[model samples]
Target: MVSAREEILNKLKKAIHPEPEMPDFDAPVYHAIDKSLGQAFKENLEAVNGSVYLCKSEEELVEKLKTVLQNVPEKEVVCSENELQELLTKNGIEHQDYQERQQAIEAGITSCEFLIAHTGSVMGSSALQGARQMLVYPPQHIVIAKKDQLVDYLHTAYDKIQEKYPDQLPSQITLITGPSRTADIEKTLVMGAHGPRELHVFLY
Candidate 1:
């Protein structure tokens, strides 16, 4: 049966490309990364009413966050470590653990990583721990993805995952695009009906 499936797939591939040459998967991946990152930046800027900063190190990240939060009054910073605690304390912003703050952010925005982007979906792994709640419960979400994580599409992301963990894929995989929206009430479009009203991505 496996052989038959392979044969069928091979035939389909050949039929689609008569030359039967290997596709330049890397090119598409690169282009997708560039395009998606640009789009994500624009969308995020608009959605978050904030700017995305690409930092090379933790120190730079802290500095950027401090600068951004300088003008925002009464902004509580939610994070997971003592490192961030130090930064927040120095900046005079209240800090809360990412896990402990989940309830508070249930109506706020969360941020996470994008496992795939084919359909503009955001993927989160359990290993990220309590960060998942940050991405789900808020009215707005922001994600910071490294350049290498970008793929041409969802299947490519899946392929990369399989390659990295041949036998240990996570039990749950989420593909989210845009905001959690609906139009059930008198067919009127509504945002944040079920979840966040906006989804933003910062590709760095």
Candidate 2:
């Protein structure tokens, strides 16, 4: 009186195989990245439809920022950092403070805690100002980062965070690899599904 399901289970039990041994995770698994961390970050970021701009000087950075802002509407752009706001104002670039205009924000400029080169990711945390909204609310995200902020691996980034905040750590940490996208609906890729459709990283 063995039913079809019981017969199938008995046959599967007879053919079951032993579990394989797990490899040593402490040992280095990935190949060592030959290029500089900055280069690796740029290449990996670009591979996921993200844009990277390397600026050599402050003037160049401002100019590049201005160029990017030109495509976005004047009032639709939001910046929360006081330093970045000052820079934008100094350059005659019109932008609203995120607090001032939370509605219809087309773009947002933010600073990240660390940049992971191996995965081309930006590590942000609730501890950082404007990280929660400036990152996900806007249609376009512009991250200002320096070459020194680049880390070779995610673990190294975490170690650095621990060192930086010895007493209190951020409540939430976010790792953004590329533009927010998903292929959930019938496997059709859709950008800006859950967050910013465009991610731009300006590295100096």
Candidate 3:
């Protein structure tokens, strides 16, 4: 007796097509677009509702941050970087130092390892910044980066990461482009589904 499973398998066996040869992927991939790295990054990031600012100096970066941080609730920003912390304190902004128990954080302000210009991505690792949870737990994400940290391509950022951590990479490395978003429910777009909905990069 031919059971339902046997009948389905026999039908599938009767229908077959010639297999096509696999294409070669050994060659390096190439992209054709505007060559301006910073401009491209700003455009790409803004396209997804993320904000980007090019700061000429640390003072300017601090001022911009102070204004933007006002949007967060309780004017609370969490950060672990000592230098940045000092600057924020001097500016009279109230921010909680990175702590395990401080769960009601308005935003996590971190410095990223590299900013990929072509893809508008901010690459971060535990060694470059803080814990893995800091990247994921916050409702808002603010990345502070210098002009030197900008790279033209994503592979270039990976190369830099490898150079920095030659022996072993950090336990967690993340590549974030714009805000956390999805189009899963009834084809409607939503942000902050899995991570921070608001992503702001202060590039100086």
**Candidate No. with top lDDT:** 2
Runs of candidate 1 exceeding 4 Å displacement: 1-76, 81-94, 106-117
Find the 10 residues in a row with the least total lDDT in model 3. Answer: 27-36
Model 2: per-residue lDDT, tens digit, 1-204?
999999999999999998988988899966688998888999999999999998898789889988888878899989999888887788888889988884689989988899999989999988777878888999999999888888999999999999988999998889999999999999999999999999999999
Predicted candidate 3, C-alpha RMSD = 6.0
TM-score, every prediction: 0.56, 0.86, 0.81
> TM-score: which is higher, 1 or 2?
2
Residue 179, model 2, lDDT: 98
Candidate 2 regions exceeding 4 Å error are: 1-26
Tens digits of per-residue lDDT for model 3 on 60-104? 888998788877764457887777678678977778777643557
Q: How much lDDT does each candidate structure score?
A: 0.56, 0.90, 0.82
Clashes of 1: 2
Candidates ranked by lDDT: 2, 3, 1
Task: Please estimate how well model 1 matches the true structure, expressed as its whole-model Cα lDDT.
Answer: 0.56
